[model samples]
Target chain A: MTAYKGYLIDLDGTVYRGKEIIPEAVEFVSSLKEQNLPYLFVTNNSSETPESVAQKLQNMGIPCETKHVFTSSMATASYLTEQREKQSAYVIGEDGIQKALEQAGITYEEDQPGFVVMGIDRSITYEKLAKAALAVRNGARFIATNKDVSLPSERGLLPGNGSFVSVISLSTGVEPTVIGKPESIIVEQALERINLSKEEVLMVGDNYDTDILAGINGGIDTLMVHTGVTTAEQLKEKQEQPTHVVSSLKEWKI
Target chain B: MTAYKGYLIDLDGTVYRGKEIIPEAVEFVSSLKEQNLPYLFVTNNSSETPESVAQKLQNMGIPCETKHVFTSSMATASYLTEQREKQSAYVIGEDGIQKALEQAGITYEEDQPGFVVMGIDRSITYEKLAKAALAVRNGARFIATNKDVSLPSERGLLPGNGSFVSVISLSTGVEPTVIGKPESIIVEQALERINLSKEEVLMVGDNYDTDILAGINGGIDTLMVHTGVTTAEQLKEKQEQPTHVVSSLKEWKI
Candidate 1:
């Protein structure tokens, strides 16, 4: 009775952007809804959570559910839990970070920490940096959320978590193994969560740097949608290519 | 009197790696100590705390103090605080995240976050994703710590923070504005902390991704020590080149 067993879709230009919804995106989702197809919102952005993303789509009349959304944050968290024994941690981020840690039942340090995890701390400070550096120097474990130097925006591209991760890595001389988009960790997480083999799922997105790379790295079929950031001309120039390409979600059979 | 008014140094290949220090690195520091030198350990790795890195180096027989460290985490976090009018947030990371927020005097939350920061949350969860997604959709600000997609390891290359940041970005339909290494924010933070002009400090590191980039972007002098991940051939092929390239930190003048 499942119209489609697994569907991993894109965000950004695919669903919404700057405060505008692209045409036909809603209709495309409506078709999936009419078919009772289960779809997942797979994205490359680690700055926000699925609930907020889904809510945005719905606000723009896309009719999305938070349950149907999965992010790199979820993927990376899943990957780390699988790779190591879960331990208490000191987080440097927001709800997305906390949710990930709590779901793993990893206790966090508000007072004293045994492990220091770095991400994009919008609220940064010298004391925080000193503490994190000290914790690592003193033998607390360290992990970074990701390593993106910049994220593109309507105004312009700007720095991201990689900059912060580098600071700690530079300061502590200890590199954090990151877990997020374009890495096998999130894909593996997605596969495990969907309860499907890699081949059964399709990765669709606009950006080649993260989404398509994620699919290729994760061992899934990738469908490049021209709806997001990358242009078709750009794809043709790439040394690598996706498994498939589409104009939008409307072009997919699922 | 300070033998050196300011110091900018490199990590990885310059300092200690896997229980061994590069030859003469210790002696070089000893010489600095023999004549009171004020120095700073600057690195491109964004995932760790400087205290931890300083300890790692000290363990390798190179003595360093926490005061002599600057990280991308602090830089980006500082930028975030400066841009925000209010200081409430939803975190998505580890010790670095909490520390940065507290030091910034930013109020943090699980819900109703004015700003949601995504970092390297190795322990991500569905609930966290949902919370962030919901908040961003509801108009909470989105920010990230860095943008490094891969990390260097004692073993090999691995997926890093950049990819994860992208994933959350995909989900939220909001791209993060970042502040870290290889960008002006962290560089400015470092300048402010040192209370010196860019001309007075020399950025040193092994990685071209961060250290060199930071100096170049910040308009500071950069020294690339041939000890870490990038090779001479790699440096030659860089889109941007460092001001000085040395065989080792020992051969370089302070």
Candidate 2:
């Protein structure tokens, strides 16, 4: 296997499943640290700040710092910053996205914003959605953190940020520039953050649709681990196969 | 003209615009009443009850009773009743849909509901959407009041029921049974309510997309007036034309 200089790892399915951490993934990440190879935990979750995400990883015996965590919210902020120097945004999200935008020096405006950014908001209301639709219709650039339609919960699969984002997109007939997994935007942003070329970085995740596809879309080699969503049986039917596939991270050399 | 025995009329654009009523529409309905022709006001609005709608029409000097108004909510309720004898539904909407379902004797059950009904809900929360999505994913029959993406409000075109409905439909990957105009479900239900055959009833409205398309889809003749949404120039681009077109309702001899 070609040794990569940097690793762009996925959370949830790869590092941990819900609250349970994968031991093999932890050992693999530790190996990356011992080899002095740069690695960042790239996540589509726009709800949690990097500090919080890193804290969770640390608690689970995984070596991670706030700087090692790259959320879609951070990627969105970076993308927006690159687009315009002083931009006003109409945001629909919780703490993680809001903090990211604030940290990126983006101002929040409701009436007529330069951009309309959407993330998963548990306190989502019709008024917020209306404002988003109106702003999008009024010619604001629409942006979404991720497009994961369903969120897996204890109860069942709940409506994800992508589903709520559809309200504005479908209403205003404007497609949002998605800055998360499978779209290449977030992957590109992560590569820039990690200071590595696409060839020098490897994207690792369990989900075939989001993680593997994101790597492929961003022109990066992918390592698909079968610890979460996608199974070995399901991967067989896929048209574009991942660069590398393993039953668990224990089998793969860092 | 065919001299239809009954008239199935559209609200909003056809009869009124917001709080303002069209004088020509009032005169046209008066003529219908003078001739003793049975008429029903069919609306895609799932927010207000038939009583409220009837009151609004009556206040505008348009002859209408609760029985004369047939909403998409009523159509949805009726459709559910016909689909199953004792059905349980997880609804996401306001008073109109709730009352209609209650009137139809359909019980509201959140856990593993038989059906998931979505309507225009201004007070929409993530929790409500989550439940609806979960129910739909859990094999519940998904139904939407209408597919009107946006609602024309005083501010602007706000996110309509269809937009909110997309949250569930997109999340669960389930296409809803839309019980409103342009689909023929609401029109079919309205026809049953008015006790009129397709040939004997003229669907009158100003909107070509909903009203005219509903008539065409339901195998009924349509009279398109130019008071609301679709203009004559816009209607000219349509392949399947209405049975009759008028600049004003006053120009048509009922």
Candidate 3:
């Protein structure tokens, strides 16, 4: 097997499910650290800052720092800076995205903006959506953190950021440029942050649709773990197979 | 022109635009009242009660009573009753839909509902959308008041009921049964309320896509007026034209 110099790992289903952490996954991450390998925890959750995410990992006894976390909000901020146009944006999100944009020095403008950036906002209101629709109709570039339709919670699957983003897109007749997994935008950004070429890094996650497809889309190898969303039986139905498969992350050799 | 026994008219674009009433449309309605022709204002608006809509029309001197108005909310209530199943729903809407459902004796059940009814809700929140998404995913029959993507407002086109409804639909991956113009469901209910056959009624309005298309879809004759949405040039582009065309409602002979 070809050795991967660095790793890009997924959260939620891979490391933990809801508030419960997977023991094997934690051990796997620890082993990577012991081997002196570089890794980053890439996530589609745009509601929390990297500092908060790192705190959550630390609480679970996982070795993580703020620099070890890469959120979709950070990716969205990176995407905006790359455009090099007007730096003003009409943002609809929570702490994570808001802080990320602020850190990137993007000014907030409600009436007219260069970009309309949306993420999962549990405090979403019709007025916010109305403003977004009006701005998009007036020809602002639309961007979304991620396109996960349903967010899994203890209560069940709730509406995700993609669902809220649909209000503006469907009303204004415009599609947003998504910046999370299943699209290569976030992956490329993560690659640059880790300072590694695609071939040298391996993407590891439990979900085939988002994580594995993201790796495939970004031209990187993927290790699909069965501890999360996709089962081995369901994996066989897919046309494209992941580079490696394991029942748990502990089975994968560094 | 064929002498129509009954008239099905639209409100927003036909009777008024925003807060101001159309002078010609008022005269046209007065003429219909003089001839003792049965007429009803069929609207896709699901925010206001029929009484409120009638009050609005009466204020404009259009000779209207509560019985003269038919809203998509009322049509939704009727649709639910017609199903004759569990008479309960998880509603995500304003006063119109809420009252209509109450009048129909449909109980509200958030936990486990028989239906998930949606309408234009300016007070929309993520919790409401989240609840609706969870309900729909858990096997509730989803229904929408209208599929009008954009609502023409003083500020510009705002997100309409369809846009809000898209959140639940997109998240749950379930298409709703729409009871509004451009869909024949609301028109069918309006036909029954007006006590007229499709052959005996003429649908009159300004918007070609909603008002005229509803007429065509309901198998009734349509009178396209150019006072509001669709202009003469735009109407000419459509393959299926309205049965009659006029610059204003005043031009049509009662």
What value does the TM-score of chain B take for model 2?
0.98
Measured against the true two-chain complex, the DockQ scores of the candidates, in the order shown, are 0.04, 0.91, 0.88
Tell me how many residue pairs clash in candidate 1.
91
Q: Per-residue lDDT of B1-254 in model 3, one digit per residue for the tens? A: 78999999998878998899999998999988999999999999898999999998899889999999999999999999999568899999899999999999999999889999999999998889888988888888999999988988889999999888888888899999999999999999999999989999999999999999999999999999998999989988999999999998888998
- By summed lDDT, the worst window of 10 consecutive residues in model 3 chain A runs over A78-87
**lDDT (10s digit) by residue, model 1, range A1-254:** 12345767776777766688876677777877888766788754555677787887788898688877777666656655655544677777766766866787678774456567766655655346555656666667777666665555453444466655655665556877666667767777777777788867877778888788888888888888888778988999988798788887677776
Q: What is the DockQ score, from 0 to 1, of model 2?
A: 0.91
Candidate 1 chain B weakest ten by summed lDDT: B150-159
Model 3 docking grade = high
Which candidate gets the maximum TM-score versus the true structure?
2
Instruction: Sort the candidates on TM-score, descending order.
Output: 2, 3, 1
The DockQ value obtained for model 1 is 0.04
lDDT for position A90 in model 3: 97
> What's model 3's lDDT at A31?
90
What lDDT would each prediction earn against the true structure?
0.69, 0.92, 0.93
| TM-score of candidate 1 against the unseen true structure | 0.51
